[model samples]
Target: MSRTKKDDKPAGWRKAEIIEAAAQCFMERGYHATTVDDVATRLNATKGRIYHHYATKTDLFFDVHRTGMDRLFSAIRPVHDRGGPARERLVAMLLAHARAMLEHHTYETVVAQGVQVHRFDQTTEGQRQTMRDLIATRDTLEQLFKSTLEDAIAEGTLAARDVSIAVKVLLGGLQWSIFWYRPQPGETEADRVALAEKMVAPLVAGLRAAD
Candidate 1:
């Protein structure tokens, strides 16, 4: 949060730093166990620094959720938009999604946990609206996948009697990584990409249309 005139960055940059720190704390400790002080310490800043940008821990947590959804849309939208065979496009989108999950591991994990929080009645009345907005964004992401799957089915590139159920199974396979994926020491981006490919292959194979 400290910036001299020479080193000054925009408020947006500082806020992003705080959100990333909060994500790490939430990923490591879970939301209930994580404190504003935990996020502050992770950034080597004071509680005032975080409170300056966010009035409450819930506010900061929601920002992380928002950012995670933003990241997912950004990462996969290009692949979704590109003109290609529907099956191929679906495969590319899945890879993009899996890579994003690995690359933005902390944010994705925290966002995943945040989704589970809705079932527990954890958010206040004011916060529930923001939670609803986040859920809408999450739904949009799912729709992106669903529409592509529908296209693939129509094109005879994929097989699914129920597109909605298929989309859930496909995304669920990718999302389950947030619960169990632990990066190994000295792993490179290429290593993660290779792992993602390995993870995505079976999922794609399962959905491929019969010859």
Candidate 2:
């Protein structure tokens, strides 16, 4: 969090520096192509600096994935836990998710890549275990939707033949935006929220029970 723009990381925030720099390196060069050295170069620190925190590239990858999961859970969990009719809470969760995905683009993109990384057998066992942990956390994230969807159904506010399918479609719609959503220059946070609301309309509307 140094004021000087040359990547001068303060002492207390060194691990954060490693994570952020590693995220950028992974985003640009990919996991296989990026090394600890690459991340150190970006942070303007020695390779030893990154090593002091993360033992290996795989460790750094998991930390990036953990950060992304943290963003998602931190954003939506509060909205999910609040007392409300399920539909309202679900809408709030969707709005929160949309905002997080659009605003935290780089970190979230790394989260999105975990499925592919899991499929690749070349990574170390530790990396695969990290992915399993991430996948489990992601499943819990989906459970938020399933819980609300059940409430909405019980109240006759929404209907679905299969709630699991509904959950997948609803959350999958949000994930798709990470691929194509880019902020237009000079756009504000309000602009992004409005856009997220618009993007989520189809799925939210489709869940409504007929009049």
Candidate 3:
């Protein structure tokens, strides 16, 4: 059944439906190969319907990337804000990120490819500002990890040769889920929860303070 319809809820809701469908389409076909028509077909709508919400495919692509960032930013905010030992808190944040990637598989996967997507072409100043806002959100999230890494070093919990590099490595590890993770047959959410736990164990172990 079609979950996307003009009257599903309201204008914003319909726009979101288009963004999500566009994200999945872009993820599957690559941005250059996807069209506004492809996005419309995904929603069981027409070119006119998609064009009504998004002036161009680039507009929809940016919205898809922005939505993915917004989701991860929101999902991890609680863990990011809570005060705790770096080891404990960082692991919690990483697991939350991994879970968001799995839950929002298509959007997050497209977001994970931002570097390549940015190479496509330049946009108008307004669109450029939208990208800047999304970049700020990403930077804020990375800063949280860098701060926690510093905190860990100060408290003698985890030691890293270079905290900035460590932040990238740790974040890259979490983003790796976007490329490789898929539910195995018969897997449940409980199973993914366990996978997150198991995955983070080695992560913390590797970061442990020497001796």
Candidate 4:
């Protein structure tokens, strides 16, 4: 049966529900092992609703990946835009990034893993285009980090060095924290923010140009 827009609920709501359900499945079973039916069942919906929004499992998976990455980048986009001293903005960006990751740990995990296995080459032309767009969005987010780092370097708030390498080290350190941070009985977001600040402080200090 052909699925049409009329068959689905509001486009925004349907897409959000499917992405949420798919993220849950992808996180639990990994992307390669997850199926469209898995997401449908998780949401207590049917394949028709899934098809109305996504042409294939690959397409839906791409949506899940994109949504997760967007959430992380959106968390810091405002901080990046709010004009301020590079050092203060950098600190805010790092803390925001860290909080987003810790709060959406499962989604972040799936996104990190999806980057390795979700190849656009495996899909049809249309699907490949969608994947390319998502990849572009991811790259755009990374550029924000790069720009902030460069600004800090130019302002002498960060030490003189390769900005690209510095951005990588910063992201790698922040992302890897997801694997080690466990919420104890009293651990809070503030605790995570403190840890993130501690991690960034030394890197920022070390990067500052000698007076």
Candidate 5:
């Protein structure tokens, strides 16, 4: 069945649908190589269907990148905001991040590439603004981790001379999973949960202060 209609009325699901298709195409073929036709082919729809929502391929790509950042926020922001020791909250946040890496694999994959802004030319004002906003979002997420790390250091749970480097090391480990993690065919959420826990323990312990 057609998820979109011929009428001009907006279906709220249409935009998200297009973004998902675009993410998959970008993930498989890369942003430079993927075309509107490629995304349409993935959706089993026509180019007009995608064009209805997004005027250009760059707009759709940025939307996919934005949606990926949104997913990361949804997964980790609540855990970061809640009351707890900073170490515990950091652990929870890292676990949540790892799970997001596996669960929203394609979107996260696109987002990782989107971080390399120098590769793409943002010629128009709108595209430049979108890149600025996306960079701000990335900084916000990193700051969340930096704040948590600072708390842990102040509390003497974790010791680090440079919080900035620490943040990069921690997040870099989790982010690298999108490259090497090949999910088993029959794996469940439970499996990913276990892997996330296993992956985070050593990372957390490495930063622990001497007794």
Candidate 6:
């Protein structure tokens, strides 16, 4: 017997839908304001489906945040693993990061906003375990950025400033793009690439040693 089209969806599709809906809810309403029912309502599905995949609203939100971080790291992971000139690799990583931010704008927005309102300490021990997992996932991506910056400095592509401070500035600037960057009707990825290159070029130049 042939399966129906709906039944033909890959196993992960349903979970992806739930995460997408939850991300939208968290973005539209603040994290504290959003509930599992809100996500189910947005998805036009029952809460059971979500509960099947996530134990609580916090768990769902944590998955949403993890999804965003995973997208970011997946995009940069190739450049990070590739052997290349440090400057070239750094540029590749920055461009990948910007593209990921644009593609996963909603998830990224929720993550930026939710971190301010959500606290792991409020959760039970099990829930806190989930929170720690999410934080570690986020920190891994951050360490990738830090490692890239350090490599650039070591290669003389960037100056010998504190890697921690440099990573902060780089990530802060990249994250703020989610807030203000509105693409015009005819805007292309090339346009965004050019803009990103322009924004980072001067900073990179400033980091070069005086000769």
Show the colliding residue pairs in model 1.
Answer: none
- How do all models score by TM-score? 0.91, 0.88, 0.88, 0.82, 0.91, 0.83
Q: Pairing residues by index, what is the TM-score of model 2?
A: 0.88
> Over 4 Å off in model 1, which ranges?
1-7, 207-211
Where does candidate 3 stray beyond 4 Å? 1-8, 184-186, 207-211
**The candidate that achieves the highest lDDT relative to the unseen native structure:** 1
Full candidate order by lDDT, most accurate first: 1, 5, 2, 3, 4, 6
Give the lDDT of residue 195 in candidate 2. Answer: 89
**Residue 18 of candidate 5: its Cα lDDT?**
87
Cα-based lDDT at residue 87, candidate 3: 73
| Local distance difference test values of all predictions, in order | 0.88, 0.84, 0.80, 0.79, 0.87, 0.78
Query: Each model's number of backbone clashes?
Result: 0, 0, 0, 3, 0, 0
Q: How close is candidate 3 to the true structure, as a TM-score?
A: 0.88
Model 1 local distance difference test score? 0.88
Lowest summed lDDT across 10 adjacent residues in model 4 is found at 1-10
Residue 1 deviation, candidate 1, in Å? Answer: 13
What candidate 6 gets wrong by more than 4 Å, as runs, is 1-8, 117-121, 182-195, 206-211
Lowest-sum lDDT 10-residue window in model 2: 1-10
Query: Candidate 5 on 160-208: residue-level lDDT in tens?
Result: 7798888889888998998998779999999999998888878877755
lDDT tens digits, residue span 1-211, model 6: 3446655878699899999999889878878889899999998778987899898887788788888888888988988899687777877787777777766778898778656645433777776676677778778877887887788888887767787877777767777877787656787878777777765665456655661
Tens-digit per-residue lDDT, 1-211, candidate 3 = 3444446688887787788888889889988899888888888788998888778777788899989988988878889899878878878888887777777778888886665666666788887787778788889988988888788788887765698888888778777887788758887788877777776666667755761
Candidates 1 and 5 compared: the better one by lDDT is 1
Candidate 1 structure quality by residue, lDDT tens digits, 25-132: 999998888999999999888999899989889889999999998999999999999968998999999999999998888889989888667776566888999999
- Give lDDT for model 5: 0.87
